[model samples]
Target: MKKWCDNAALLTLHGNTVGMVSKEFVVSAPGKIILHGEHAVVYGKLAVAAALSLRTTLHIKTIHDKDDVLLHLPDIGVEVGWSVPEIAAAVALPVCDPEKPAPPSEELLQKLKTFASIPHDSADTKTLALVSFLYLYCAIVGSQKTLTPLEIRIESKLPVSAGLGSSAAYSVCLAASLLLHKNLISASGKWSEKDLQLINAWAFQAEKVIHGKPSGIDNSVSTYGHAVSFTKGSEPVILSQVPSIRILLVNTKVPRSTKTLVESVKKKYDKSTVVMSAVMDTMEAVAKECLILFEKMYKGKADEYYKQLEELIYINQQQLDIIGVSHIALEKVIQITKANGLCSKLTGAGGGGCAFALIRPDVPKETLDCVIQQLSLEGFDCWETGIGAEGVTLHV
Candidate 1:
C-alpha cells in the first residue's frame, strides 16, 4: 500500500521529536448494527449494517517524562500499565506494519499474554482489551526507538457484548489516535480515503484479537462511518446516499452467545441443506431489495418509500425467526413496537440482544415517548438515535 502522510515539515516536527513534545487529543468511532442479514451472512449472503450514534471515545495523552504506557478503561473498571522497555525487550522483532498490515502472530500474542499476565485460555473483555492495546502500541509506536510514554483512557456509550460493535469502535479509535501520534495520518480536517483504509486495516487486526474471526463489517462501519452493504469475501459498498433514519434501539439485556447462535444455525442448515439454501436465498433477496429501496429513498423521501422499507423489515424478521434466532424478548419487542404503529426487527446475532424499531418522520413525539416508556416498563433499555452517523473522527 502507498504511504499517505501529511507534509514532510509536519512529519519532522512530530515524528522526529516524539518524546520532546507532549500531545493530548481525543478520537471517536461509532458502534454498528446489522440492519439486515444476520445468520445468512455466514452463508455468503449480502448483509447491511450502519454506524450507530452511540460511539466509543478515546482520550490520549503523552507522558513525556515517564517510561510506562498506561491504559484506563472506566467502562470495564480496568486500569493497568506496562513498562515500555519491558515490552520492547519482550518483542525483539517488529509485529505490526501499518503500510503492510497482517494478523497478529501466535508467538507475539502469547508473548503479550505472558507480559500482561493474561491466561492463554482467557477471552474476557478486560483481557482482550489489554492485549489489543499492548499489540497496537507495540506495533504502531514501538518501532520508534524514542517512543513516548502515554496514557489512553476509553469511554464508550455502546454496551459490550450486546451485539453492538463496541469492540470495533474502540479499536478504530486506537488506530486513529496511534497513527496521528506517529504522524502517519493527518490530524486536521477529514481523514483521506487512504488514511481511513489504513486505520480500518489496523482496527480489523485488533478486532481479530477480540472476536477471533470477525466478518469485517463492524470495523468497516466503525472506521468509515455511515452505512455499508457487505457480502462475504468482498469489499464493502458504502451507501453514501442513504439518508439518516431515526429508530428505537431496544436492548433486551438478556445475554446471548454469538458463537452458539451461529452454530445452531449451521446445524439447521446441515440437517436440511435444500430448505436452508432457499431460506438463505430469500434473506439475500431481502437485503438486495432493502438496498434498492434505501437508494431510492434518498432521492424521494416519500411515505411509500418508508412503507416499503417497513415491509422489508417485517419480512426479514420473519425469516430470522424461521432460521430459529429470534427469542421471546425479541418477539415481545416486535409486538410492542407494532402495537405503537412501528416496524421492528432483531439486529445482530439475535437469540436476544437488541432490536430496533423504525420511527417514521410523521410519528408524533408523544407516540414515540410512549413507546419508549412502555418498553422501559417491560425491562428493556431503549435509545432514540439515528443510524448511518459519521464514522471515526478526531476531536480538535
Candidate 2:
C-alpha cells in the first residue's frame, strides 16, 4: 500500500491542459459492529450498530503519464491493472449520476466473472472484491465525460468475513474516492450532508454486489460514522455526539459460514414465525434500552452506567443463543471473560468468528491487562480499540 499523507494536498503542475490532471487525496471509512439485534434487523426490528476504531483506508493518487489504472490491495494479494484505452473500450458505460449511481449490469458482471476466473458461486474474497471495484470504477468514473488515470490502494485494520463490515468499508471508501476523483466532490472544503448521502447510496450498490440482501446498516455506519439506531425501511437515526467507548475485541480465528448461519436462523423463523417475531421484538426493545442508557451513561454516572450496559450486553447474548447463533468457541470466550468480571457477547453472524468484551472505565488497569493476557494465552487475538469514530473523512 502507498504510504498515506495525513494532510494530503492536490498536486498540480505548471499549467492546466487536456488530459493533464494529477491530484492526490485520501478517503477512509470505518467498519462496524452490531451492538444489538443483528439477525432481528432483517425482520424489520431495530438494531444498534457503531463504527469501530478499525477502518479501511483508500489512498488515491492521480497520474498524468500513466497508461493504465493501477489497483492495489496489499491486504488481499491483488495487484492488477488494465491499460486505460483498453479498459474504456471493454467496459460499457451506463448512465450514472455521482449522486445516484446505478449497479452494474448482469451482462457486464458476467463478463467480469469470466475475466477474473471466479465462478458464480465461489466464495473467494479477492475475486468478489475485484468484481465490486471494477463495477464501481466503470459505472462511476467511466460514465463521466473524461476519465483520469489514477492509482487506488486499499488497506484495512479489520478482519474480512468475520462480521466487521470489511466489504462495506471498502465500498464506502471507493465511492468517496471515485466521486472526489471525478471532481463531483471537491477536496477544498468540508463535505456536505448531500455529499455524504451520495456516497452512502453509491456504497449501497457495492453492498448488493457482495451481500445480495444487506440491510444497509453496514454501508450507513461506514459512510456516516458513530452509532445508529437502525431498522428496515426507515432512515437510521444517527448518534453522532455519543461518547467514545473502549472495548476489547477478541478473534477466535475460527471461520464460520455467514450464509449457513443466517439460513439456520431463517429456518427457525419459518418453523415458528409467531414465536420468532416476539423474540425479534424483544431484541429491538433491548437495543432501544441500550441506546437510552448509552446517552445517560455518557452524560454522567460512570459506575452505574457500566453496570447497566453490562446487563444489557449479557441479555442480548442470551437472546442470540436462543436464536441458535452461538458456538462452543464463543461460549468459551464469554465464559473466560465472565470469570474475570467482564461481560461479552458475540458481535456478528455468529457461528464462530469474533466476539468482544466491555471494559468498564472504573476497572483497574491491572485487571484489564490480566483479561487480555488470559485471552491471548488461550490462543485468541485481542485488540484494545474504541468505537464511535468519524466516517469517511478526507485527510485535509
Candidate 3:
C-alpha cells in the first residue's frame, strides 16, 4: 500500500514581540465535464467524466475575537454573517446525522427558502447555494464544538449553470476546509485516502441540499480528481493514470432546462423502446472502448485512438439529436468544428448549454484560430481548458 499523508506546519511566529498568527486554511477542487455521456446515461448507460482544469477555492481564516462568522461568496454575490449563537439556535432545525446526512427537512428547506427570499419549487442559485453552505457549517461546526469568529471566502473560475460541475467543486472545497478547520483531517500534508473519502461523502450531502437526486458523479470526480467511468448501480472506476487533452469548451449562451430535456428523452425512449435500447447499447460500447483507449491514448498509436474517439463523439452527438436534446446553438458549434475539420459534441444535458471540441495534436493553428474566432463571433464563450486535473487539495 502507498501512503498519501504529508505533514504541513502551522502557527508560525514572526515577531520577537509575540503576536498571534491566525490559522489560515485554503482548500480547492476542480470542476468536471462528461466526456462520452449525455442524456443516454440517465437510463443506465455508461458515462466517462474527467476533471476540468478550472477550479473553485475556499479560504477560511480564524479571527481571534468573538465576532460572527462572515461569509463572502463573490462569485454568486452573497456576503453575509451569522453569530455562533444564532447558528446554535438553528439546532432546532432538523439536521441528519453527520455519518449519514439525509436531505434537510422540508420545514428547514422552506425556512431557508423564506429567509433567502426565493420562491417555492424553484431554488435559485444563490438561495440553494447559501442554504447548502449554512447547513454544512452548522451541521459540522455547530454540532461538534463551540463556534469561533471566522471568515470564509469562495471564488471560482468556472462558469456557473453551464454544466461544468461548478456546484460540486464548490461543495468539495467547502467540505475539505471545514473538516480541516475542525481538525477532522490533517491541515498541511498529503491527505489520506480515507480522509478524502470522508470529504467526498460530506460534500455529496451538500449536493443533495442543492439538487434533490444528484447522480454523485460531479462531487465524486471533484473529490477524487482524474478520469472516471461510471454506470448506474456500479461504483465509479477512477483510472490510475489518464491522458491529458486540450478541449475547446464553448457556451452557446442558450439557456435550457435539464428536466425538460430529460423528459424529452424519456418520451422518445417510450415511443421506440427497442430501437432506442440498441442505441443505448451502442453508446455503452463506445464509452467502454474510449475508456480503454484513454488508459494508453497518450502513449503509442495516438492517432488511431483519436480517430476512433472522434467517431464516438459524432455518433453520441447524433444520438443526442435523436433523443431530442440537441439545440440550434449546439448544431452551430458542431458546424463550426466541422468546418475546421475538428470533432465536437454537446457535453451534458443539452438543448443548448455547452459543447466541447477536441483539439487533436494534428490540428493546425490556423484552423484552431479560425474555429475559435467563428464561435466567438456567434456570441459563444469559448475556453481552451485542460482535462484530467488534480482533485481537492489542502493548503496551510
Candidate 4:
C-alpha cells in the first residue's frame, strides 16, 4: 500500500512527441516458501505459503530508436534479443485480454521454441526464461500498431531452481511491468483489486510456460503478497493481516526433479493407501492449524503461538520424511537446526532443494550465529529473512 510512481516525464523520440508517462521504471515481486504442506497439496489437501522478503526485480527501459527487445538476466548470465518485427511476423499473437487468459497452445510454444533457436528437448532455465518472456510480451502487447522496443534487465535475490518460486516472482514482475508499459493499468499508488487480479491471471499463463503445470499458489502470493492458505481446485485464501516472521532459509544446493518427487510420493501412496491417506490427512490438519495460529498471531503476539507453530513444523517435517520425499542432505539440515534449538522443514518439493528453520523472536544472536556458521561450513547457503512481504509494486 505504498506509492512509488510519482515522477512522470515526457520525451520526444524520432521527431515525434511521446506521451507524458514514465518510460523507465522498475517492478519487483517477492519469491515464496511453503511453510506447511508440500507434496500433500497435490492430494487436494490444504497448504500454507508466504511471500519471502527476497524478491526478483525487473528494470524496464523503453528504447525509441531500437527495433528489437532485449532481455538480460545478469544473475544467470543470459542475454537474448528478438527483433520486434520478426516476432510479429513469426508468431501469431492472440488478442490481448487480461480478463480471459489462455494458455499457450502446443503449436504456439513450438513456434516460439523454434523462433528462439532453443532445442526442442531443452527445458533448461535459460530456455524456459526466454520462452516465458516472449510468451508474456507477445500475449500482453498483442497486435498493437506500435510495439515498444525496450530493454529488460533482471536481478534477483532469490536462488533459481531452488523451489523458492523464483520463476513465479519473475513472471509476476513481467506481467506487472508489461501491463504498466501498455497503459492498461494505472501508474498510481497501490494497485486495485481488479488490477491485481488481472496481473495474477497473466502471471499464471506465464507460469504454465515456465513450468509444465503449476498450482496457482506461487503466482497468487507473488501478485497479492502476504500469506495464503491454498487447496487444490480452490482460490487462494489471502492472509492480509498476517505479521511477518523471521526465519533461516537454507538451500541444500542438491538438485531434484519435482515431477520425480511427486511420482515417488504417489508410488508410496499406492503401496499403502490407508497409511498414506492418514499421512496426507495429518499434513492437511497441520496446515489448517497453522492457518488458525497465523490469524491469532496477527491479532496479538503470543509465545504460546510460536511454540505451537514450531511443533507443527516438526510434525510436518516428520510427515514429509514418512512420505519418502526427504533426503539425507535435508535430514542433515534438520539435524543441524534442531541441535541449535530450532525446528526445520523442507519447503517446496523436498528431496533436497531448500529448507526453512523457524527462528523464535527470543532466540539469542549467538545461537543463530553458530547455526549459520555450522551450516556454512557444511557448504549450505543460509539467509535470515522474514516472510509475509509486500507483493508486486512499481518503483520510481
Model 3 stretches astray by more than 4 angstroms? 1-22, 92-103, 106-122, 298-304
- lDDT digits (tens) for residues 264-318 of candidate 3: 8888899999999988887788788888888677667666677887888898888
Q: Relative to the unseen true structure, what is the C-alpha lDDT of residue 63 in candidate 2, on a scale of 0 to 100?
A: 63
Model 4 RMSD in angstroms: 4.7
What is the Å distance of residue 82 in model 2 from its true position? 1.4
lDDT per model, in order? 0.85, 0.81, 0.79, 0.85
Error of 2 at 55 (Å): 1.1
Residue 280 Cα positional deviation in candidate 4, in Å, after optimal superposition: 1.3
Q: Residue 355 error for model 4, in Å?
A: 0.5
Stretches off by above 4 angstroms in model 4 are 1-20, 93-95
List the candidates ranked by lDDT, beginning with the highest: 4, 1, 2, 3
lDDT of 4: 0.85
lDDT of 1 by residue, 1-396 (tens): 112222333222232353333267778899999888888888999999999999998877777667888888879877788788888888865665657668778988899989999998897876887898888888888655445688777899998889789999999999888888887887563689999999999999888887688878889999988899988899998877777888899999989998899999999999999999999998889999988887787788546688888988999999999999999999999998999999999998898899999888989999999999999999999999988789998775
Highest-lDDT candidate: 4
lDDT of 4 at 224: 89
